[model samples]
Target: MQTHYEQEERFRLAKKRVDELKGFYGNLVSYIVVNLGLMILNLMTSPEHLWFFWPMFGWGVGVLFHAMKVYGFTPFFGKDWEERKIRQFMEEEKKRNESFKGE
Candidate 1:
């Protein structure tokens, strides 16, 4: 059973995660709305240059990164890395304990 503090910490973490998800969703909605407006403005004014793609690309990159962060999809130092580190340390500790027993 978790202590009261542990439960509170878990709740806090959950709330933080929820907030991150909410923020990402908000960003996505804004990106869509703003880009649509930009596209319309571009089409109405300068159909030849098509400068709308620039902001779309830049903000697309931002949205991608925001999604990655909110979803914890890091290419490096993610859950896989954490699990590998835990296993490595556990193995090392087991070896040390065995050596101690031999001594």
Candidate 2:
């Protein structure tokens, strides 16, 4: 029952979401591959000092946040909340405009 414009909008949003997923996955793969290399290098070069975990943990946190955002698991201001706020503001603006037009 949706119009063409609505359908196109949906498709656009879906495509954007897919792109986000792709980016997040690429980041994740890079994190793993690079971290593995760093870990091996650290172990070989300075097993006693053990410094690989620092970057690993920091990058892991970043990856976790990226995953959370891409997957819409954000605890605050998630996608649904954002959409609702957008609609709410649009409706309010429409009402205000209509009221002014009546005057």
Candidate 3:
């Protein structure tokens, strides 16, 4: 039911999605490993001061956003929202073009 181009396009989109997932997972793993190391170092050097949580919290926030974006947890700016906006813009453009052609 689909053309070669359509199949290829679907494959490309799927591959891109997989790549995004891989990137998010890689970022998460790095965050965990680095934060764990920092926590241990902080505990070993300055257990009283306790500064590891700062970096951990900041990086954790970044990772959370990354995961949200990759997982499409963004309610307002998700794929559906984007597609709708794109269609809206295209309709507006088409109307404008038709008006110009009529003139």
* Full-model lDDT for every candidate: 0.96, 0.97, 0.96
* Candidate scoring better on TM-score of 2 and 3: 3
Q: Order of candidates by lDDT, top first? A: 2, 1, 3
What is the C-alpha lDDT profile of model 1 across 1-103, one tens digit per residue?
8999999999999999999999999999999999999999999999998999999999999999999988899998788999999999999999999999999
Higher-TM-score candidate among 1 and 2? Answer: 2
lDDT of 2 at 70: 95
Tens-place lDDT per residue, model 3, 1-103, is 9999999999999999999999999999999999999999999999999999999999999999999999889987998999999999999999999999999
Q: Which window of 10 residues has the lowest lDDT sum in candidate 1?
A: 69-78
RMSD of each: 4.6, 3.5, 1.9
Off by over 4 Å in 2: 80-103
Candidate 2 lDDT over 1-103, as tens digits, reads 9999999999999999999999999999999999999999999999999999999999999999999999879988797889999999999999999999999
In candidate 2 the C-alpha lDDT for residue 96 amounts to 100
